[model samples]
Target chain A: MKRERVTLRFSPDAYDKAITYHLVRDYGLVVNILRAEITPGQQGNLLLDLEGEPADITAALSYLSSEGIKVTPSERQIVIDKDSCVDCGACTAVCFSQALLIRAPEWDLAFDPDRCIACGLCLSACPVRAIHSKFSDPIEEAPPADEA
Target chain B: MATKTIAEINEKIRRGEAVVLTADQAAAMAKEQGVKAVAQQVDVVTTGTFGPMCSSGAFLNFGHSDPPIKMSRVHLNDVPAYAGIAAVDAYLGATELSDGRPEYGGAHVLEELLRGKAVRLRATAYGTDCYPRSQIESDIRLADINEAFLFNPRNAYQNYGAAVNSSSRTLRTYMGTLLPKFGNVNYSTSGCLSPLLNDPYLRTIGIGTKLFLGGAQGYVAWNGTQHNPSRPRNEHGIPVGGAATLSLIGDLKAMSPDFFRAAYFDGYGASLFLGVGIPIPVLDEDLARCVAVTDHDIQTTLFDYGVAERNRPSLGTYSYGELKSGQILLNGKKIRTAPLSSQKKALVIAKQLKGWIEQGDFLLSEAVAPLPQQATLHALNSKDEVK
Candidate 1:
């Protein structure tokens, strides 16, 4: 039987691979053990694709959540803002798993969540303040209005 | 101002509809499309900009007859709408036919005319700076019932040249350059650059021509705003100005078959081009200025921008040579690639590789292809291992 894969999606702004990198490095999760995919996006979000034993997937989720990696049932993806980003040309180095890439000198940075082993080493390396954690602090929902 | 549903608005238009939905009505419809609020109260929908509007006309021939089909303006109209946005004018172009019908001639005329053409529409309701949508809608509903409300290009062309900028000389020159052709045209000289970009309702109007001409570099910050500075200038190491941008207006008409083209002119304050369309994205104005450079020079620029790699996303297994070679074979077989080239197959070899790269299944290697000279990739993964 084919093992079912758990899918997750980060908020467009939360698609930072740095959080994934941290999960991989500190959590001992194998970046290549699962699938990471960038979905065809109108909003252009990066998705993480992973598959393994149920325990392993659970462990991956735990680690991802601890690192603030946002996961959804829909996709494992990150959204990149091309304008606010400055291409430091650095994220190309730490991704031994080959998940992060500098597309070209002129274009801003891009991350291949598929190749990313969820390693977070590149998180600190980015100088331009471009990269972000997939799971940022959850936004507080507005309190229910008083129904006098 | 309560926004109206698309059905209600369409119904009004259908039912000899003079009912102007309140701003709220329009905003609510816009909200369904992920827009928050209609920043401007104009019901007039403006379209996004066209890319490759520059240079496409320069090197390539769109195949128009020599002396390039003489275009003349038949009519122009400056219309006032209740939508709170500035009055818009439409220009129309009709071929001078011998037997009362146009001699369906060349490609460029149809192409360029359709690309930049805008027709003037008739609107009746007019009020001061503040007119509630409900009031406007009721007024329009009550006004004289003329089924002819849509703007025609001919009327737009006639009045567009007459719009007075701060100075008559500059405005006259603007008219002279554009008026000669008289093809369908849509341009706003009211200096309302900011609204064109941020207005949710206008932005949603998927089909319509809109252009913002003359403004400052600072305005580019707002989405969808395109400003062409009056001179060839640069900002933040990016060049802005000259006929570079003016030339692009034609280029966009030449390049894309989809969507009408829009142009913006902002005085020299910034150096960059910002455009949003069916395929929305901002391309640096400096790159546009590179139109002055040769193909080789442009290729060099593309290399700097990482065009070869970014343009072609792939994983480790595929190489440019193999893809090209595959094309040759497919060509011999008369096979077509789907979306990518023309093999017309699901999951081409290169796209599969790209899937792998994105999925973390493989490492991209230099074996794929030699990095073009002046190429650079700024990956965000620190552990990026180039295998």
Candidate 2:
């Protein structure tokens, strides 16, 4: 079976109702309500495992956009930053992806790269703020890994 | 060149020998034996207001303008008194013995099935009636007295891996949608909807080691609007508790197997009719083992029964002895029997079917076998006496 991966950033305000009809309903994916972290006033990331034709993915995006969802191709295939990550543990606490972790000292906070969907969730999750997204390049770099 | 007789099968079963056959072998044997076969059946029987509807989650949503969702009835009044009779008839072309003598050759078939005991039932009233939540619970308790039952929690929930949409463009292929979303995750859908959709239910049946072992989540709900409320003022009152949701995630962090171990290597069993597309003899032994395991890992829950506050499990334990020996359920009631085997049904069936197919006699085929000869003979005898 063919499958595609896509991430849509829900406006931080897209709360309960958005979770119901949009992400979970239209896409057949479940967004971790608990793993979400928004920077006081910033867009939140919704990772979706889209299965079907490329047209279907585009259709879902169009529907979401029309419904007032702010979606963009995610950057930074990896979620966590090795440097400046202090291992302070705020990212892990807010991460529903279970992608980021604070193991300890210099070696603790490692990005699983494989588990990271590049939803840019860690950007807001990080207390020290050291994560970067791929979209900021204003163009395409490479399709992210199929991990998440 | 000689096919085994019922007596020989019985002897092997009596001696506790393994019953084995591949689906091809079972089909060939059944064809040679002249037994009919039917595969993949869904029989939904509802006692009250709710009927089977397709939604990934337990709770269904209704718009005020949308009519009330009523479940249609599914009946199984004619299911053979015993679980594997269809397979037995299909295998040896012989009827089940009312005399209680063990059908030894295929005893394993009767032994390996994972027959459901605790039949969970849940319903919520949307109109004028008092939230006789107690009565709904009472009916469930009564049903529980008759059979093991399940009721969704007090909230409505949707299926996590389901795609619900109004347009054709949204119709993602079921197979395509399965993996990207459900693949690599250990998840259990609410009682395989494939059966309801007239599709094969056990198609996804396999071991945790064979498929992705996703983590398990429980108590998922969906809240949707209700129509025809007795109190017009409370028009916005949405109904919950319409469904139950659970997810199994397959990941290393969970220490679960990434691939569900490939078992039941041969033959196919439909979750709907709980029928297998193989020789009756092979299916019988396979199902018997499945039942034994199912009998073991069982529990039941009912609210008015007040079992929630109690330590009683989800489905009760196996206790077949009290239920008229041959009759598994007494008036639809379980007797807390013990599992005849150690492994689950899928595992046992997988092993037995694989073993059977390796032998030359096994076959895989399909047909709905005729009613047992004894039933025919008894009817003929009664008519003769009357004449």
Candidate 3:
């Protein structure tokens, strides 16, 4: 099984449609809605974590694009600029996922990309403005609906 | 067991026969063997604290150049350092903010030096008869300096208070970012592993005492600035609020970058994370019992940040043991509590200090004088009044 964090930009017309419901029924993907900002008849955003077989995840991404919804990989990550980062571990306090941690004996900041649920809590916890939101990662293949 | 002298402990250390234990180790030993038995055999208890100290800085001698400029002004990587001292000597204060940018400060400059990075050095002076160069803009690294020593005015706080927000709005405090509307609580201080907490009365941890400072050999230069030993205490002799601190001196060249980092609080400015370790000699059953005090016995009142006053009303007091359970009850709500201080680093320091003593390299010192217990701290006048 594979997991990916993706953000869906829903158009006013698509907002009224049961988008997540179809993904689960059609592709057999486990969709965990982390955050939802969209309302019916309004262009807005929806953040979700989708888990399923690699083939199913690829097909789910393809289906969303077919329904006129813009699909993009969130792939959110917490980046600590070493020069600015103080390793104060403020983020570790509110980090329920334990993705951001202080390595023992050295007390250096360590971020595990795999463990992050992209809650975006550490962005505010850092005192020095050291933590940055990064979308750059090895995003899994989510081909456009026409190709896959 | 009779009270042992510092001389006896040093002699044992010199002979590689000293019985030493880290604060965490000592706590466990006291529980298993009892404070009496442990005190009889142990020669020293190594304690440590890793926290953000704003009063930390270093004085550096950059060594004169071909045309020596009696540096009346100095800038390291665009961040200014106080240059009024001498030709090349300057003091970099931790809280000094960089030009315009509040986030980058003296701590960041020190970190750059620690990492052996070249800094943009700019200085100006009135041309003297002997030393005639007026201005200089050069790149300098820590390797080019003659001497660099960190003489921190304060470090190793005995104990600190826990912070939580009672108001509905979030508070960006000098303490780590407090979540909005009592969403979470944050606290600093190493709790049981803290240096002064283990010593309680400042019995053996004193001036000239050896310490593991920023992963290097250091010493207590003096009682730390704001050495308030008169804070009210509980039955266990632990200060309920802010208490004693220590001034430490160490070679900045030997300091580790890993332990020392430049920090910026959201509302408050830049400060350095100072790692300090002090070894306590188990002189008698009394001293041992002090070290044995667990987190359950060490309690402090959690203050609401909403008041924005020094006298923030206490939500209630909770023991370190209870706080460390990872959740604290606040206003009938079980709010999650997290420690800003790295207990993981504190434990590392304890183990390192123990290793130094067991190797017969570190020596414990007798206090020339205990930190003042009777000195009353002066409160600032809320309103100006005249007779």
Report the alpha-carbon TM-score of model 2 versus the true structure: 0.22
**lDDT (10s digit) by residue, model 2, range B153-267:** 1111111121112222311121111112111111111211111111111111211102111111111111122211121111112111112221211121222111111111001
Ranking by DockQ: 3, 2, 1
Off by over 4 Å in 3: A1-32, A36-46, A51-58, A62-76, A79-89, A96-117, A127-132, A135-148, B100-102, B126-131, B381-387
- Report the lDDT of model 2 for residue B76: 17
The alpha-carbon root-mean-square deviation between model 1 and the true structure, to one decimal in Å, is 26.7
Candidate 1 positional error at B368, Å: 50
Per-model CA lDDT versus the true structure: 0.26, 0.26, 0.80
Top model number, DockQ:
3
| lDDT of candidate 3 over B1-387, digit per residue (tens) | 668988999999999999888877788898998888877888888887778888899999988988788999898877889998988899998888888665789999998999999888889899898879999888889988898899999888778888988777767777877777787777787888888899888877777777889889988888888888998899989998778888989999999986787777777888888788888888889999988878888988788887888689888888988777768876678877767787777777888889998998887766666566665566676565553
| CAPRI-style docking class of model 2 based on DockQ | incorrect
| Candidate 2, position B82, lDDT | 22
lDDT-best of 1 and 3: 3
In model 2, which regions exceed 4 Å deviation? A1-148, B17-144, B148-170, B173-348, B352-387
Q: DockQ of candidates 1 onward, in order?
A: 0.01, 0.02, 0.36
Candidate that would win on lDDT: 3
